[model samples]
Target: MSCGYLLQMDERPTLDDIRRAPKVLLHDHLDGGLRPATIVDLARENGYEGLPTTDPDSLGAWFAEMSNSGSLERYLETFSHTVGVMQTTEALTRVAYECAEDLAKDGVVYAEVRYAPELHTAEGLSLDQVVEAVLEGFAQGGRDFGIRVGALVTAMRHQARSMEIAELAVRYRDAGVVGFDIAGAEAGYPPTRHLDAFEYLQRENAHFTIHAGEGFGLPSIWQAIQWCGADRLGHGVRIIDDIEAGDPPVLGRLAAYVRDKRIPLEMCPTSNIQTGAAKSIAEHPIGLLRDLGFRVTVNTDNRLMSGTSLSEEFAKLVEAFGYGWDELQWFTVNAMKSAFVSFPERLELINGVIKPGFAQLKWRGARPVA
Candidate 1:
């Protein structure tokens, strides 16, 4: 487990060092992380020839470029191709399998990959079938690749099927679905619109995260926590808007409440930049949030779209904020602690896997001072 090269004197950890470090991902879109080649093959098999490019490399570049348009709507439009080829059960299983494999290769020890099951019913697959296929793929991937994968069944915020999706999530809670979520543009369709689904999840003692404070501002975050009772805030980058980074750094009521409650903020740095939530990684609120003791967890919102992996995200933070092994370990532990999995399982992974993994890396040498 020890990467000796990372122990070199006077050296900041390299990308390879970050790759070798264990990671925990709490927020990633299933449809948004498909391999470009998989998309091409699935499209060919399904005879859906609407792809911008037949070549996988070009297709991958196209997705990155489209998602970098600085408009959340334009970024989301890139999903049409991914979702188009993911309608069939085989395709769903394959995509889910590859997602786990890719994350494992990048050193993600644990991940909760989420997708809106309603988006894949075009081929007549039931919501339950969609969940089952994805679960089967994750189970297979875990057996093959030594990584634990959990499914988060998401409902689109702009749609009216939140209650049904919530029901689907509760129904499959013991069958591999770890939690429920709502994703989409956060402006016009607030998390409050799905209050019934949130309330239902609360009643069932289920866990759920809300897509808030990304494309919108403080009001969106306030409503997600105050109104809907979100367990975590998805891309809660907008909380930065309420913080005054002056002498002693004053936090607004909403930001203070989020911090006081220790609600995890699933911050996706690259995706936030792509959506214009943060001007740059150097300017990201995650640095301040971490400094201020907020429960912050780093994530990859969409690997394919952002052209990033969990390792790459960690590397970016290292470069931007001069973070080192200790900072990296802090983020990883935060994510593992915030996972929706059972407390005993979470503790086992933290003690047996994540802690040991970081200890090996730290044993390599002293981390550079942050």
Candidate 2:
């Protein structure tokens, strides 16, 4: 008996379909996704004249171009401007608010947007104040736009404030903060350096993800999971290095452990390409990871830097792999399941929003293929 699944899977999803499909984002950076116009306005208001261009279009292009340098340091340098203008309370709130609104418009039903609070304290705002401002903005934006935005309080790995940030994250757990993370250059500044923070979160039963396996290699991934006990791996594209493609792909000890443990990998395809983690979207390790039944989730590491959204990421995947609604739904569900939100809330979204959203699109373009 024909199951009819192949018929619906025959046609590729269009951009519209991709946009309307309910999406979940796990690794987006708040400082990395500001509106170019907002950056310009904030820069001028703050009397900061460091922007490469005052023109919004040109500034946006410049951010993308600078990020495409294939050097993690250069890609990170783009944040100096975004973080520069976000020191004040008003600026932080506005940026947070708009981040939620933009994600809602792109059909991201749930997102755990992260930012390093330490980076926003240049103008004397305390870490607590910065967290409160961003939380307020996320609350307002969520109420207005009908999307759930959970803030991940991040500590720069190179800095000495991971424990402080982890405490801040726990303090705001009930308010809006969902988890904790350490983000920045992964090479010299390993996750082990922030061992105190990870240990604290673990003791407090708070969830956290470590930025690993992007700029670095398996050692980074291994330490994040084994030593630090990250709940998820941010930009874990380098985990691909351990898997040797064969008739039946052979997984090294680390790879095998990751798959066996069902550790969630937040794979950001375009951002990986931009940072030299992957050659291109078509050759991204996400494809192989998904095929191997690893718990993989799609993400926009930085929408502004990669010039991408959750919908755009899914659209690119479809274009590269010819995925249909079912595949998209699978990825969405995987993200929803891996989210730091409470189990009941995750179930609510999976059943209430995501499943129904994709079901409507599943048969829209299906036709019999000879």
Candidate 3:
């Protein structure tokens, strides 16, 4: 006789299983994820006096506080404290090393951590020195934990250093720096403001992503892709606005173009909610996009600020969308595919690591009960 559950598919990975499953991250912020204890230690060492608290747990809660005003300025003010402490090479390297370690322990097989080189130059470190320090830490951490990590050099969109930062990214392309990005308020300062930098990167065949459709609207996303030639979009949850909701949703020209072109959308549910981009995980556009076959990828945009990790992000989607192992694998594969890594390298990871990892989890879940 057949077993009672043999006909059923294994679904809803337990929290433990989710944590154990291999994950890929492409939008994590380095300064955004420092452990609260690390912040205290770094602040003490650096003589930085701006911390709201000295205790780890309190600092964690403090950092996680969502601004009541919903002002982008207020949202960005939190980074000032983080960037304040991360002025020296030691602080930057320590923060980066712990980043890789934490992600690896969370079952992240690969991650592209990003930061602005200009932000860390306050302690008199050159842009090159800052990049080197971070690369060193990621290398050491990756070697120690058996995880692969890459860097994305980000420029503040509202600043004038994008051209200079683009040059810095190109100079370190052979190093661990895998791509370039422009992040800041997307309202007035558009990606086209840095058109020269984008054009240079395009000439060099370099990769880049733009922060759009999160703070602004469809116009920002249009400029990021059509004008600036962004390879991917950062926190592109706002693209859903272009879709008319229905039993069979209709995609506007921009939405259809994004889907037809398979442009990757780095959707951060918790972060979106924190910033008022989405009301909740269940109401997030990721569900609709995923259902529509958009190349949607999950990410923890700012882990500490959002109080999330790749595993936790996936678990949220799992609960909200009833995602099974297959859905998790799809998201993971989408991220790995959209990574700035070379084609061959991405293929190796998809076949050698992510696929096998999910296969094992699926297998374990599908087994009959004793």
Candidate 4:
């Protein structure tokens, strides 16, 4: 059944209902989603002594607080500890496995988790070793958790290893790696700086998404899409700057192009707020972009940092924008469509998993509570 636009008066997805529906995640970070207790355990096991707090509760709160400092640069610094402990093969595999388990528990049927290999090579392991350990963990996690998790080998935009990482991503494409990405501070480290990696992926028919228009502005986005030819825009919230609000809300040339081509905007509401990308969940560009028919999909950029899951993200939107089952389902379908997977696989998940799951929720919602 196709997704309906109508919102039944009593049909908005509660936090409980949202948790039961199938979902797809296109933008998420591996290091950014570790369980706080796991971090403490890894630090102890690895003999790495850099955690701000040994207590798991304080460490979890520390991540959320540090990430909420309202500066993207400072927010990114929180990764040092996570990346520090993740240097060992065992540490990397455990984190990846638990990531799959956690997402499955939250009802995420599919997710593409991206991580930088160079970040995990601090301990003398090769980049291939890092990727292999992560892939193995996710493979085991998927079997145990009944969820599908794909890896997107990421290259840090601030660093110079993008070409090598792009090659690595292609090498492991068939072995659970789905795509490539450039993630980091989007300001000084423009996507154009790594044009070689993006061009190389393009020439080889590989897929990639660029971190653009998040910490920077339109020039970053233009460079990613027009120059490097990114397949999707990671946190393209700044595209809202190009539109003039009015009766029809006139879109500028760049905005028009993005909308016309259906470029997927991987908007992470809580993370955006934490990074000062938006003021709050209620005033996020996602609401405007969704209303304007842009292909906007919701995501939990960093589950631990944001102290949220996919269900919480959707629930926040429901409280902020009064979203119902139809809106939630539309976002799920949009994410499945924007996924780096093959068309047939995306279609199967949309039809066989997402739609049926939401249909059941809506049917139950339209009836009185038992």
* Model 1 stretches with alpha carbons more than 4 Å out: 1-9, 366-370
Give the count of colliding residue pairs in each prediction: 0, 0, 0, 0
lDDT of 4 by residue, 123-175 (tens): 89999999999999999999999999999999998899999999999999999
Candidate 1 residue lDDT tens string, 50-160: 999999999999999999988898999999999999988899999999999999999999999999999999989999899999999999999899999999999999999
Error of 1 at 106 (Å): 0.6
Q: Of 1 and 3, which scores higher on lDDT?
A: 1
Worst 10 residues of 2 by lDDT: 1-10
lDDT, residue 266, candidate 1: 95
| C-alpha TM-scores of all predictions | 0.96, 0.97, 0.97, 0.97
For candidate 3, the clash count comes to: 0
Lowest lDDT block of 10, candidate 1: 1-10
**In candidate 2, what are the lDDT values of residues 1-370, reduced to their tens digit?**
4445335544688888788888899999999999999999999999988789999999999999999999888899998899999999999999999999999999899999999999988889999999999999999999999999999999999889999999999999999999999998988988999898899999999999999999999999999999999999998898889999898999999999999998999999999999999999899999999999999999999999999998989999999988878788998899999999999999999999999888777766666444
lDDT of each: 0.93, 0.92, 0.90, 0.92
Clashing pairs in 1: none
Give the distance in Å from residue 152's predicted Cα in candidate 3 to where it truly belongs. Answer: 0.3
